[model samples]
Target chain A: MDLEDLYRILRTGHVQAQGIVDTVPDPMLVLDSALTVQSANRAFFRTFAVDRYDTIGQHLYDLGNGQWDIPELRRLLGEVIPKSSAVIDYKVEHDFPHIGKKIMLLTARTVFNPDNVSHLMLLSIVDITDRSRKEAEFEAVFGELRHRLKNVLGLVRALANQTKAEGVSGEEYRTAFLGRLQAVADANDLALSDHGDDSLDALVARATKPFQTAPETIIVEPSPPLTLASKEIMSLSLLLHELATNAVKYGALSAPAGTVRIRWEVEQGDHPLLRLSWRESGGPPVRKPASTGYGTQLIQFAIAYNLGGNVEQNYRTEGFEAEIVVPLERAARPD
Target chain B: MQKTILIVEDEFIIAMDLKVILERLGWRVLGPVPKVANALRLLEDELPTLALLDVNLGDQLVTPVAEALRSRGVPFAVASAYDKPELIGGAVLAGVPNAGKPTSEWSLLEVLAKLSPP
Candidate 1:
């Protein structure tokens, strides 16, 4: 009723309001009609890395050496708030000296003080830098996947055209085309199945699994555990497929008594190299072909060009042999 | 004389098929080189009437080879799965002909026709 009594009530209300603002989790600020910050919550200081002394009574755009002076932020606070009485999700991206680049979402509402009939703005800031970064990374990964898919499809189209043009019978072309596509599909499946690198033995087994009549017929020599990158796995798998296909038609696997032996070792040095050998024995006496075929070109390309390695195919009188030496760095295993 | 065309693609199957299509069309096919280094070497040793280049060569871009072919005045067309101009460096490939990936034989021939020597 009296002047002193009214003053006490006002002081208590102010303290209560300040305590409530400090308890809020998101950064918040109270600004007068002039757009000068009258009060800030504890979160405001922590989120922006500024002290109350530097923030209070300062223009919102002038805080932290003008790091808060974002063009989008200015439009939201200046035009949007005045017209609409509120703004939601006003995004601002700025490079702050202390915290680097950050993405912030701001929401603001106009509040009127009944006693003075003056308008005040209540602003809240949400730091969305981490979420925005993760979203961008996910988009990039998806884009890469789409690009790779397109390339794979392109390869498939080319394969079909080449097979059809080879003058092979329709059935033969169909079989051969499907076989090549399956090889590609198998490699892709292996790459996506597990995040960890694939073992060399696993790769060989997968490639040769479809061609083998019995496990013991095609001997895979015991070798140390070695892992290969996904790209290397795909190339090597396709390479082995071509080799096994040749063996099935004309090499060791064509005959019951014939045998094929695959062995590999890692030569450790300044740059580690994987030395792999494929040897066939006891087949019909072998002779080098006069002309190169698509299969031969594929093998050479996969090993030499794709793997950044060297491949030598020697058709000895007794059997056929292929030796491959590839750099370890290019085909690194997951540590 | 049959025109000799060189192909520089990283994918083995694609390169092999391109060779077949070109040969069927009565063109002599030269090195379907898969690496930038190999492609550059082949370009220096043998000159083909035209070249078809894949923009991405495994871990490397084919821009340097493109630049080389440009300097030699060798007409070539770029083949890539990437349609985004920026991804393939728009400025570098502004005037170069492009054949989008998954290109049919007809599409490939169309682009090659554009680069055929007069």
Candidate 2:
């Protein structure tokens, strides 16, 4: 072939090589034998917020806030490029003079020239900072899920132990246990809203929701925001369930003209505490039970033990009276 | 007159088991009635020798009924999953004693039999 024809062939080969470099999805840099960056593709510019035009002949470390000055990265490029292909992942942080903030992922490899004489290093960078951050968040959620399940199982074991009879079959026991657990879960669901925990407003509302079936049977007083802990919220929820259940059967909810008043306030001043009460009247004459059952125990447990508070349950002539006094610090903040 | 015991339990299956145990012991046994109101109404008409009560009835507390039994001088025992005993004045409870739940048939009847046999 003529020399001019050979020159044209050589020029076409260069164009084809450049075309291959430009089409890659990941950011890349082509460095000469001296390790000076010869060219940067468009993806490199977009990925790293750099100018492809300015990268020509610049050293890799001189660009983009000198993030490449990391000793690890330099060592990787120095020793790793001469032997077999080296793979690495590293995060480089840089602030764009114009763009707010930026993070980058860098991968690089050495390339041999045609005839295997000279060398060139090609860096392939995939920005993965966002993906890594989301992955971390997902792991935290899974951890919390595992913890919650453990707590539920622990409570079920306690319930099973305290029940006097191995009376129900495994299937039936599971169903019944689920029933109560669902009730408690519902209470927790209401108490724990979009946020991780409930605000005082939401917690009271949660306690009052189920009783709304017989509206006005239970009264709730306005109180300030006091974060209730999960344990306190669950205990209080169970108390409301028992009280409302009683109201439905014999107390205010039992009669058309009957009414119940429920109110709460975080006692302030020197000693901050919480006081709540359930007062029922107008349904039937209050008398003591022939035996104590789960409800009574739960009420007592809620007020006296869980909240570390005072409880007074009085079987008055007209209706039943219940009071709970708890310390304010026992509250939970919503997520 | 034979000693009679009335059973008030919220759980149906639980009440049935207790019935078998109480009847096997030669006690004149009435219903395994499942609610506070029903038990109270029944007792208002005919008093039993003793009662076995469960406090939380899913929708009510049977504490008032316990009080009614105390006023009428009838003895009773408690069977429940909850560990508290405020309704029976801890003293009376110590004598009759509540059987904390998930108990076997043997333990259940044993507790029932020990309840001041007439």
Candidate 3:
């Protein structure tokens, strides 16, 4: 070939190679044996936030104020590539002053010239910061889920032991334990439901639905919509279950003519408060129990401690009445 | 004097069950104290022969009480639902006896028998 033709062909090949390098999406660098940057791709300058003037001909460790001087990088380039001719997925994690924290995976290979002597190293960098962050977040979530499951299982075991300790018949224990477990399950379902936050009315309805024998026997008065926090739903469900169990056994729902009225009202002030009442009538004459039972203690504890509320029950001859006053900040959604 | 075993558990039902089991075993059960502060307070007033600790008390870890018992040369066992290696770490907790939760009566008694004073 003529000299002019050869020169044009060589120039075109060089431009084509440069174009391919510049067009590559991943950050890339070509460095000589001395670790001085001979050339870099467009992505390299953009990804590292350095101008071409600041990068070309600069030492790899000196650029970007030594941000690229990672020990892992040094090891891969200094030792690994020399022995293996290439290295892949050499990970480096660092907190750069310009980019905060980043995780990068590097693949490097040595390139040789026509003389069969190694001329330069081609290094490709993949920014895997987001992927690594998502992986870490998934691990944390999985760990938290495991922790919660363990705690729930522990609580269930405690419940089973306490139920057995009541000295009731096997059938009675099964019935009571199943009911308590259902209450817990219901609360969990409500918490994980699509709404995330459930209304107080809906919670009461769900808790008392299984106990209702006939319609209108339990009258729920319409009240202002008050959303309950996810944490409060479980305790409130258990409290309602206890109250309903009492009504069914001895208070109001025991008789055909008995009626139970549940009503609530919100009082707004410097600190809002929700006052809920459970009044029973038309059943057998109510008398104060000789001593509080475990159910009573659980209900009172749930109200007083879990909801940060006060519970007062008065045993009158007509019926049983219980009132609960809860701080809105603890149970209610903010306006 | 009967050897006393201090119980630190947050769950009331679990505490009651542990109290019953320990008492039935002929040991005087001390505080089944629910809170770390209350347990620490009990420690100030009385020194039990041994202690049974639950690793998690609501939001607080039982590390402080564990550390206190270790410094005082008091023998103790941890009863928790969490995996021992994952939840319990550090040089202080190395080799401390652990009873996994939903703990069988036999395992609990075995650990207690080991800790009981001769």
Query: Which residue pairs come into collision in candidate 3?
Result: none
TM of each candidate vs. truth: 0.82, 0.57, 0.82
Best-first order by lDDT: 1, 3, 2
- Model 2: per-residue Cα lDDT over B1-118, one tens digit each: 7889988865443455566567777887777676667788889789998888775654477777787888899888777554555542334444455665644556666667777764
Per-residue alpha-carbon lDDT of model 2 for A176-269, expressed as tens digits? Answer: 4554565577656865576744555666666567667665656666655667766566767667766776677667678777878877777675
Query: Residue-wise lDDT of candidate 3 within A125-210, one digit each (tens)?
Result: 98999999899999888876776677667667766765544567889889878887888788878877887447787788889899
Each prediction's RMSD over C-alphas, in Å, is 3.9, 16.2, 3.7
Candidate topping DockQ? 1
lDDT tens readout by residue for model 1, A1-335? 99999999999999999999999998999999988999999999998889999999999889888877888888887778878988888888888899888898889999988889788999999899999989999998998888899888997787677554456787887888888788888788777767543778777877888887976668899887788876777778878888988888889888888888999998887788899999999888888899988788778878776667988999997888999898887456423
Q: Give the CAPRI rating of model 1.
A: medium
| Candidate 2 overall lDDT versus native | 0.68
Predicted model with the maximum lDDT: 1
Q: lDDT for every model?
A: 0.83, 0.68, 0.81
iRMS (Å) per candidate = 1.7, 12.0, 3.0
Error of 1 at A218 (Å): 2.0
lDDT of 3 at B23: 85
